[model samples]
Target: MDLEKPARPPAAAPAGEGCLVVAVRVPVRIVVLVLVVPVRMAWDALVVAGRSLNDTLLRPLGRALPWVGRAVFVWPFAGLWRYVLVPSGKGLAWLGKVLVVLPAVALHRHVLTPLGRGAVWVYARVLTPVGHVLAAIGAGVRTGALWLGRCLVVVPSAWLYRWVLAPVGRAAVRCAKGLARLVETVVAGIGTGLYRGARILLVLPALAVWHRVLAPVGRVLAVVAREVGDALGHAWRVAGYVSIAVGRRLGTLLRRVFVEPARWVHRSVLTPVGHVVRDAVLRPLGDAARAVGRATRQALAAARASVRRARADLRRTLLGGQTGAERKPQLTHRREPNGPRTRTLDGSTTALTKD
Candidate 1:
């Protein structure tokens, strides 16, 4: 495998560039560079200022904003929800369940359920049978009405349509077809004439203007616009390069003038001074403070002991009774009585028998 990357081929220049484009490009680029440099520099300055503002102000404010919002907005509401509103809501829910829901459930179960059952029973038993009877009567009446209508209206209308209306309708349809044919022929001729007139009067002239005049002007304008655009882009890139060089020089100057000296002083002078202070002053002061604390604690303990003893003696003298420290603890358990020792076969005492 090759370790080095392959070099890319150079881009081919465009083939059809005219002298107009070349002529436009040079002057446009020069003008654009002059115009864009100041804008690019200002843009870079704004970018630096924005970053400094974000670092110095906005970032700290952003971090603190959440805590401030929580303190001002979230925490009080949370406290109200946790300490006040939650309990109140629970109480209200319980009250509503007891006063409203329970009674509604009971009413539904005891009264409404029975009433609905009775209504269902009535519908099933009485109203259903009555509706069926009424529906049967209505169906019989409908059958009679249909029979009367068929005899009185339907048969006559069928005969009239078949014998009287059909022949006249056929004659009228034939006349209409001839009239439509004539109208279509006339319309076709008129439409052809109009189409020819519109083409000669409007379309030809518009086509000539578009091809002869507008197109050439548009092409020239497009070429100029394209050159301008290319020039702007090229100039902008050059400005960016210039900006980067200026920024680097300024950064080097600032670093050499200020930052290096400050760093040197911090490293050489402040660090050793801080170390000396810590070792010579702070460490000794800390040691002395620890010693004093120990002495103070010991003295306080001794004083506390002396005060306790004095209090105990004064209590005993005034009350005429022993203090708790003077009292002895009584034995809680008694020793068992020993019996006479029993002799074994070798004339030695056994442990359980001796006791």
Candidate 2:
């Protein structure tokens, strides 16, 4: 048992590829690469930009769009369906059930069902017996007709066919067979002549044209088509490589010129400046704002307490020595037990004691 994989055979060279194809392929590939590289780079750039735009802007917008639509369009329609349309539909359904469905049901049950039952009863009791009587009469008539026809027509036809018509028909058939043989021979000769003439005039010439003229032209066209297809495939592959190389070089140039310097500025300059601003300016501002808020809240609380004391003193001087807050709340409703206690052995409510 050999476990090793078999070596594949080398491919044969294409018989159709000539000097013309070889000469065309190099220049075509070079020209195609030049033309395609710019387009490919633009395509790649557009693809990258589209992905970035989708990530940065369009995806968030798409996610937000459902909520916006719910707020603007969906919620209002839902409210209308829930509050207005649903009730209207239910009311209409109830009205239709009352006006249409109920009447139809009553008519079917009271009027149509009884009428259908009566029609079925009449068909079964009266019409079925009458149909049976007519069928019996028709069968008797048919039997009499068949007997009379056998006596008057069928016996005579049998005798005529056996004695007179059969002998004449046999003589006629013999003559017809002889005439048919003669006609067949003449037709076969004519058909043979026509076939030969048609072959000489039409078929042979058409065959020659197909073999001599069309076959060579078709083969040349096939060769040219194959060469053109191969050339195109080669050119497309070369163009892809050229496009990738150009894109990498352009990307490197752009990164070196713009991205590195911007990164350096952000890391080395802006970050330190931001830190300094946070410590020096924003921190002190936040602390001062918090202290001001605390002082305002304390002053407002003190003022509120002073107002309450003044109100309490005014109430004592004016209205009999008590403010409303000092008065006790009165009970309006009483709390009660859930039910009476269960009977014990000593109680008369027990079954034995009652008996």
Candidate 3:
């Protein structure tokens, strides 16, 4: 065997080094072309092609055209590129910058603008409807904000008055004194009226008239009480009868719910179906199962016997020819031997000879 070392793999390039080299070279090549032969050749080719095309096409047109017409045809395009297009492109960039600052300027102007003048102009315009909707929404928001601010300011002051500055006991005492004075004045007036009425009333005889009127009312009330009691007693008897009837009906209904029927429905609709399932389906299936079991057992027994015969045949084949050493005595001889016998290959039999 040749004892030689294996070759090693090449090392990997460093990251970004390959890309940086390519980027540097590509720009340098482009600069060289732009600054040297390619730029000169391109400029020369463009001038030559332009001159050739102008000579071939425009020379004929110029010959046929008036000078003023040609000048008019060229001047607008020339002016458009030099003035409008170039300036507009630059202005567009400037406009982009302006847009960045537009929101701040808009906010300042909107805030500083007089609301009254703006609203008058807004209402005069056809956009007044939209303006009104926006103004309404804005006013609603302003009102809500003012309300919220007022609540924020007032809630603390109210809490402070209630908790820190309120004189609860003094107010309660003043209220109680006022209420007591009002009550005492009313009671003194009533006492004065009674004092005046007592002297007049004894002379007037109003008490005797009240007594007579109350005696008649008492007799009438006794008669009304007896009538009402009798009516209520009759009502109670009717209610008791109704309750008994309802209770009997409810008991009968409950018994119907809880008790079995007086007579059962003989020969139910499912009886035939149950009989058919048991007799037709289940009986046939049971017979089939028994037959399958018997056949499977018989097949198993036959297979076992076949396996035993195959095993015997395999043993005989493996043992080769059945020599005396290989033969089983019980299988080889049908009866018992006399003493000992030997069989020769030539078919001669010899008896045992003792020494």
Candidate 4:
């Protein structure tokens, strides 16, 4: 008769847990693991023993085998090639070499070298002595000739000039001095008279004419010429300015009439025409080329794929399917662990371990 309202439905078990739960459960896999662990431990012990044996004893021999192979088998060939084969080949090569080289050496020693020696001896003994004698005789003759020229011709010429020519020259110079003194006395009187007469007759009249008449005329003419020159120069400068202005106007007119129209035609008409041609003809060509290139690449890829497939099949057949082939994406299967799978918010199934 005392019903406690069913404990008020357990008061909603708080916000985190709906109800209290307590259970003693053991998984079947855990029981299986209990049996598997002993066998697995024994197997692992055996494997560890084998690995220890391999590491301590067998792997050392494996490591040394390559070095032994190199030393025992390959080293003999290398030594033979270097010591025996190479030397034997070189010796055999000398056997053939003697055929040509011995004859050449014999010819040089017997015929050619003897002739060369005889010619050298003759040049050294006969021709060299003759050349030396000729050179000495020529040198002696040149020295004698130079001595004769100096003593015979040069000394006599100097002596004759010293005694004979110096005395005659001194006598002639004394006579010329006496004649020059008498002529100078007469010429001085006549030059003084002529100078006074010429001054009165010519110089005074010329100076009076130049100062009274020519100087004034020249000044007037200079003034008129200066004025005319200034006017002409001004006119020339104005003409030059006019010419430059006209040239600039003509240049501007020609540029507007010719260059601008040509530029406009090229910009508006020819450029568009060229672009249209390129788009029509060249663009299609370029597209076709690209398409051909793409097709070629695709064909090469397909051919390579087929070749790889053929090679894979051949290997599989030859090896009796021992060639491990990669599986396709959908055909792949994985034996999952015995753990819970949680569906993530992103809808991917993720297996959570028992940790």
Query: All models: lDDT?
Result: 0.94, 0.93, 0.80, 0.88
Residues 171-267 of candidate 1: C-alpha lDDT, one tens digit per residue: 9999999999999999999999999999999999999999999999999999999999999999999999999999999999999999999999999
Expressed as tens digits, the lDDT of each residue in 41-97 for candidate 2 is: 999999999999999999999999999999999999999999999999999999999
lDDT: worst 10-residue window of model 1: 333-342
Clash number by candidate, in order: 0, 0, 0, 0
RMSD of 1: 21.8
Which prediction has more favorable lDDT, 2 or 4? 2
Candidate 1 vs candidate 4: the lDDT winner is: 1
**Candidate 3: Cα lDDT at 88:** 99
Clashing pairs in 1: none
TM-scores for all predictions = 0.46, 0.44, 0.24, 0.38
Which candidate ranks first by lDDT, i.e. highest? Answer: 1
lDDT of 4 by residue, 227-319 (tens): 999999999999999999999999999999999999999999999999999999999999999999999999999999899889988988887
Single out the weakest 10-residue window by summed lDDT for candidate 2.
330-339
Per-candidate RMSD, Å: 21.8, 23.6, 46.6, 31.6
How many pairs of residues collide in model 1? 0
Candidate 2: clashing pairs of residues: none
